[model samples]
Structure formats: C-alpha cells, structure tokens
Target: MRRVVQYSTGNVGQHSLRAIIGRPDLELVGVHAADPAKVGRDAAELCGLTEPTGIVATDDVDALIALAPDCVVYTALGETRPMEALSEMSALLAAGINVVGTSMVWLVTPRQADDWLRVPLEQACAAGNSSLYVNGIDPGFSGDTAVHAALSLVTRAASITVQEIFDYGNYDDYEYTGTAMGFGNTADAERPLTFRPGVIATIFGGLVRNLAAHLDVELDDIRERYEPWYSDQHIECRMTTIEPGQLAAVKFSVEGVRGGDTVITVEHVNRLTSKAAPDWEFPPDGQSGVHKVVVEGEPRIEMSTSLSHPALDVTEAGCLSTAARAVNAIDWVCRSPAGLVALEDIPPTELIRGVMW
Candidate 1:
C-alpha cells in the first residue's frame, strides 16, 4: 500500500482526503490545511467521510514534508499564488515525495512549460528522485487523456474542439461566484484577470500545444478570446446574488492556429444559471455540467462526458474527478522515473481502476 499525504482541504483537497482514506491500497499519513479553522480537524470530518481516521490536519508545510510519504496530493489553489505553489511543490519533490495535483494547470504538459517554472521542478525531482504531475478535469482527462484516446481511432484530423459547459449555481462557494469570477459585477467594472489576454494561454495553452505534439503537428500560434453575459433580472442562488444586468456568465476560448486555420480549441462556458446565456450551447446531457471534445476531420468524431456520483452533484462530482485523477496517479508516478510527466506519459486506464490493480 502507498502512504499518502493530502495538501489543502478545499474543494478538491477534501475529496482527495476521502479517496485516500477509502482506498485499501492507500494509507492516509498526513493532511495540510492553510485555513486556521481546518487545522487539527479530523481528516474524515473534513471530507465528510463516515468514520474517523486519527489523521489531523495541520498548517506546517515542513511537518507534512517530513512525513516523506509515497506521494503528496497537492490540491491547493495556485491561481492566486503560482510562485508560492511552485515553491511548495519543489520542496515536496526535493523531499523525495511524488507529487500530483491540480495546483499548476500549466504543468499538464511539463515539457512545454517555461524554463523559469520547469527548471526548478526538474532539478528538485532529480535531486530527490521524485516525479511531479499536474492535472484536473478540463485541462486533464477531457483535455489530453480522453481526447487522445478518441483521436487514436481516427486516421486523420483537421481540428479538435473541447469544451466545458457548466452551471455555477450548483457550486456553493460565494467567493468563487461573486469575487473570483466577477459574477455580480457590472459590465463597466474592470474585467477579471481571468478574462485578460494571455491568461487563458497561461492556463490552458499547454493543452493546445500538447495536442499538436500528440498529433505530430506544429502550431503557428495560440490565441485567447472572452465573452460575458449579463443577467436580465436580479437573481439569487445558493451562493451569491446577481443584480439585473450584472455579469452572469463568461465564455473563454483558447485556439491553436496551424497554417492560418484553427486546429485546436478549448472553451469554458461558465454560467451562474443554466438559462443565463441562451445563445451559448448548454450541456446536451441537460445536467449541471458536461464536457465534450469534437474532432473535425475524416471521422468527424465527438465525445461527451459527464459526472454524477451516487452522493455527488455535478459540481461536487467534478471536484471528485479532479481529486481522483491526481490520487489515482500516485502509484504510477511514484514508480516511474524521476522527472515531470504528463497525462500522455502514463497509462490512462489507471484513472479508471485507480491503484487497485
């Protein structure tokens, strides 16, 4: 069995903690939480699990690293503090602990990552003989592994389009809905950094570039576009309230250009309400969320995936999947050579069977 340490107790971290405790092949060793309230709490209680696991959450990164478990599931938010996240990841890797999580979206394609971000990680991994992998739902399974699987059945492909259409109403996080996403803000309000130019490129550009690499094609450039929809009337939900004409939905797209034609595209249709943007296509499943990848080519294929666990709604299921992807990869990453790896570098089926096999 692999010994595992969980980092953070946020949306994904909580799920990781639960998964680690439930897996017979994994032994929960430690858990780290940045929030003061979560520190010293039982791991099971933090994740809503049925029984207590003796493991208490702590804030000391040094203590967590000292565990030197087989892997550290780092699910802390990196969007607000990328450098700090990198530093922590480096420290864990240098401590000889395999690292896997959703913290760094750009590391989904490690080779394509910038030197400033990649070198320290590589050096650390080499020094400690450890490995690091970053992944999540959109930039992870639906982006590379699943898409590549779909492409394998095709002989030729001209373009690939992947999308995440999700309704934010089901997610009960006010900070995410109102502040981070700028949901209730007016159109004149300064745009959220998430919508700024190159931000999409900074976050998901690797998926486009990685797809090109997978297909043995070259990209001319990667481009980003953003569009927002305003609510027509005041609306209140479980999370936050939105005034009429306030930002209700946002669509972000990243495209990879090849020979003047768009060859790869990734889009996110995030809305506070299912009906917020009638023009933008909602999930065909009619569920709270749906992820689709379309290939415009000889076979012209389309793959639609959804999440609905017995006890999880679409939003919670999404977080669980993100945690599952990273947690399940722990064994594979720990057994592999010391370095940064990508989804394409590992057996995708491990995501299905987990560490059971």
Candidate 2:
C-alpha cells in the first residue's frame, strides 16, 4: 500500500482526499490544508466523510515532509500563484516524495514547458530521485490522452479539435469565475487573464504541442482566439451575478498550426447558463457538461464524454474527475523514473486499477 498525503481542500482537493481514503490500496497518511480553518480538523470532516481517518490536516510543510509519504496528491490553486505553487511542489519533490497534481496546468507537458519553469522542477526531481505527474480533466485526459486514443481509430487525419463545453452555473469559484474569467464584467472591459494574449497558449498550448510531437507534426505557430458572449438579461450565477450586457460566456480556441493550416485545436465554450450563448456549443441533449474530441479525417470520428455523479451536479462531477485523474495515477507515478512523467509514459492499464466493477 502507498502512503499518501493530500494537499488542499478546495473543490478538487476535497475529491482527492475522499478518493485517497476510499482506495484500499492507498493509505491516507496526512493532509496539508491551505485554509486556516481547515488546519487541525480531521481529514474526514473536510471531505464530508462520516468516519474519521485519524489524520488531522496541518499547515506545516516541514511536518508533512517528516511523514515521508510515498506520494502527495496536490490540487492547490496554482493559476493565481504559480511561482508559489511551484516552490511548494519542488520542496516536496526535493524531499523525495512523488507527486500527482492538477495545479500548474502548464506542466501538463513538462517537456514543452519554458526552461525557467522546467529547470527547477527537473533539479528537484534529480536531487531527490522522485517523479512528478501533472494533469486534470480538460488540459489533461480530454485534451490529450483521450484525443490520442480517438486519433488511433482514424485512417487519415486532417484537423483535430478538442472541446470542453460546460455551463458554469454550478461552478462556485468566485475568484476564478469573477476575476480570472471575467464572467460578470462588462463585455468591453479589458480582457481577463484567461483571454489575455498568449495566456491560453501558455496554459493549453502544451497539450497541442504534445499532440504535435506524438504525431511527428511540426507546428509553425500556435494561435489563440477569444470571443465573449454578453448576457441579454440579469442572471444570478453561483459565483457572481451577470447583469444585462455584461459578459456571460466565452468561447476560445488555441490552435496549433502546421504548414499554414490548423492541425490541432483546444477549444472551450463556457457559459454561466446554457441560455447565455445559444450559438455556442453546449453539452449533448439533457447534459450540462462534456469533453468532446472531433477528428476530421477519413473516418470523421467524434467522441464525447459526459461525467455525472448521482449525488453531485455535472460541474462537481467534472471536478471529481480532475481529482481522480491525478489520484489514480499515484502508483504509476511512483514506479516511474525520477523526472517529469507524462500520461503517455504510463500504460493505460496502470491507471485503471481500483475502479469499481
């Protein structure tokens, strides 16, 4: 059994904590909670578990390192404070702890990451002989792993597109939705951090480049396009309120161009409500969220994956999948070499372990 430490207790972290506790092959050794209120509380209380796991959350990094778990499931918020997150992860790696995480989306393809961002992580892994795997739902399974699996079915390939269509009504991250995404701001206001020039490319471009590398396709450039949808009426969302004429939704694409043609694309259509953008893409009938991959080639394959939980809504289920992707890969990551590990490096069978029958 692998000893595991769960970091953070946010939307994704809560799910990670629960998954660690539920897995019989994994032992919940410790938890590092970011919120002061969460510190000193039982891990079970933080993740809605009825029975206590006998592990209390702590804020002391040194104490967690002292425990020396086999792996750490890190789901902390890295978008706003990437440097800090990197430092934290590097510290853990330097302490010889394997890590699988959803933070630092750019690290989804560490090989293609900027040298400055990649160097420290590489050094940490080298110093401690540990491995790090970073992934999540969109920039992770749907955009790369699942897309590659679909491409294997095509006889010939022309253009490939991976899309995430979701209604964000239930997404309750106010800092992310309100500020980072610019959901409730005026349409004409300065572009949000997510849509700023080169931002999408920096975040999702690694997935495109990774795909290009796997296909042996050289991309001349990576391009980005952003479109915002304005609300026609006042709408109250879980995160923030959208007034009439305010930004309600956004559709953006990051395209990998090869030989002057768009070869690979990562696109997203995110709306506060399904009614916000009738023209933009939506989940399949009766669904609220989906990750779709469209391969325009000889076979013209289109694969759509929708996730839902009996107890949680579609958005929360999606968050759960993000956590599961990281948590499930713990064993594979621990067995891998002492550097950055990608999804392609780990066999599919290794990730399917411990799933319910």
Once superposed on the true structure, which residue ranges of model 2 sit more than 4 Å away at CA? none
Per residue, candidate 1 scores C-alpha lDDT tens digits across 1-357 of 899999998988889888899988899999999999999999999999868899999999999888879999999988678899989999999999999998777888888898989999999999999999988887788988778767887888888999999988868776653566778889999987777777778878888888888778988899998988999987777667888889888898999998899989999998987758889989884778888999888888989898888977788899988888898888888899999988878876665665554
RMSD of each: 1.6, 1.1
Question: Any residue pairs clashing in model 1, and if so which?
Answer: none
Q: Could you tell me the TM-score of candidate 1? A: 0.96
Indicate which candidate wins on lDDT. 2
Give the C-alpha miss distance for residue 317 in model 2, angstroms.
0.3
Query: Quick one: best TM-score, which candidate?
Result: 2
Clashing pairs in model 2? none
Residue runs of model 1 more than 4 Å from their true location after superposition: 176-178, 353-357
> Can you give the lDDT of residue 137 in candidate 2?
93
* Model 1 residue 92 distance off true place after TM-score fit, in angstroms: 1.0
